[model samples]
Target: MSTAAAPAPPGDPALLTGAGARALFRAGLDTDTVGWAAASAQANLIAVPRADAYDLLLFAQRNPQACPLLDVTDAGSPATALAAGADLRTDLPAYRIWRDGEVVEEVADATPYWRSDMVAFLIGCSLTFETALLEAGVPVRHLEEGVIDPMYVTDRPTRGAGALSGPLVVSMRPVPAHQVAEAVRITDRYPDVHGAPVHVGDPAGLGIADLGRPDFGDAVTVGGDVPVFWACGVTTQAVVAASRLELAITHVPGRMFITDVPHTAYRR
Candidate 1:
């Protein structure tokens, strides 16, 4: 007898509610959350020991564009104010286990590695605004290709906070040249989700040599659309690796925590 897990059904992910997406992830549906729950917000997860939580908090405050703070959980707690009854260890589609600056394991469930001293930080994610871009007639290439958006490590360095410091990371999207202004205007309202384009036009200005390759996530075709860049919460992962913390946990790049909070809540 064969015993294989079933795959997630084909449908518009945007149709799922935040809690619905969490339940699917908890049930072992591992996939990126782009376009999921279009009306809700999404977040990047980073958990560190209680002793290092302050450093992470300071880091976010210093680099709001790259690490916008959303909701944080108390030490040893999996609960978050952003999502009622969501388990931090099991609610996300995937988690990365880090040790001494290296990713040691990628797992569907993080319960085994979660420690009582761990404090989880939920940082705002740019994926939350892709829906807005689509509604405004700005194309999001990765979503159309059904892949995670590409993220690049730029020449820009973020401000240091305590022991945490690293270069800024940005996620790229190909926006129609004429619609670039509309894309920026729509996203700028959601400051909590890495709002607005940090750079546009030439990738070299940010020291990115090739759009074909990215530091994280998959590369999508840019074609005639201009490449638009936005500060990404994955900057936290870079900081974690650079700081060489003994242990850390973060969401796999692109697989985000779908928050119950609506996108409108952050739109200004």
Candidate 2:
């Protein structure tokens, strides 16, 4: 299926919990009111069936950089022990239903997509790193400017597996030259969620010459002090696109499945 540009709608800030977000997502999907990216980004989801959780976790294992494993619950259970205690079927805002590698329909609830064979996977996100950067007083242009992070498909390649493997995708952050090393040191601690940058300094070193453009997220300013590049969770999109799996699920870039686990846990 072709990629459709999702429309940007003002999301209700009140829908923060997995249950609340899922309900809104389902309503939005039923009405086709929110864009694909917006729905997935803001929605909170729970994976009920053991099989669905297994499949999702396995997919993440197959692609570590893009789908860094987070947490999983007991088999056939709806609530995850770590993230939130919301029902998986009704919590997410929307789900893009797929069948045998094809985009069949966009559904509000994945309960219809759930089979006894399905599994839920909680992939790591770039938002954690961004938070680290901001905390360290690093200049994150996009967030400061109220824009999306600029992502690009670099010529660099990533490790691959049976159904996963694709180009190395990098998320650009214009960090001031002075704090680049600090950014690396701070983010390096969260290995489970794409810790540390894959590259630093020059984009050309990573075979990326241009900074004005990106492959996935929006672009922001790159001043003299701002050096570019970091590993991204969005790389999973490329792997998903390349593998062309019969079916897959992921959080939209910028939007993520926010867990109840505190940021301190990731530091360990």
Considering summed lDDT, which 10 consecutive residues are worst modelled in model 1? 2-11
CA deviation > 4 Å runs, candidate 1: 1-7
lDDT of 1: 0.92
TM-score of candidate 1 relative to the true fold = 0.96
For model 1, how does the per-residue alpha-carbon lDDT over 161-195 read when each residue is reduced to its tens digit? 99988899999999888998999899999999999
Candidate 2 C-alpha lDDT tens digits along 1-268: 8654433333654234434444444444332211222212221232323423444455567656555667654554546555455555544544555444444665545565666544555556666555556667877787667666788888877676545567778777877877888888887887766777888877888777677767666768787865566667666556556756666554445544544554556775
Whole-structure CA lDDT of model 2:
0.58
Work out how many backbone clashes candidate 1 has.
Answer: 0
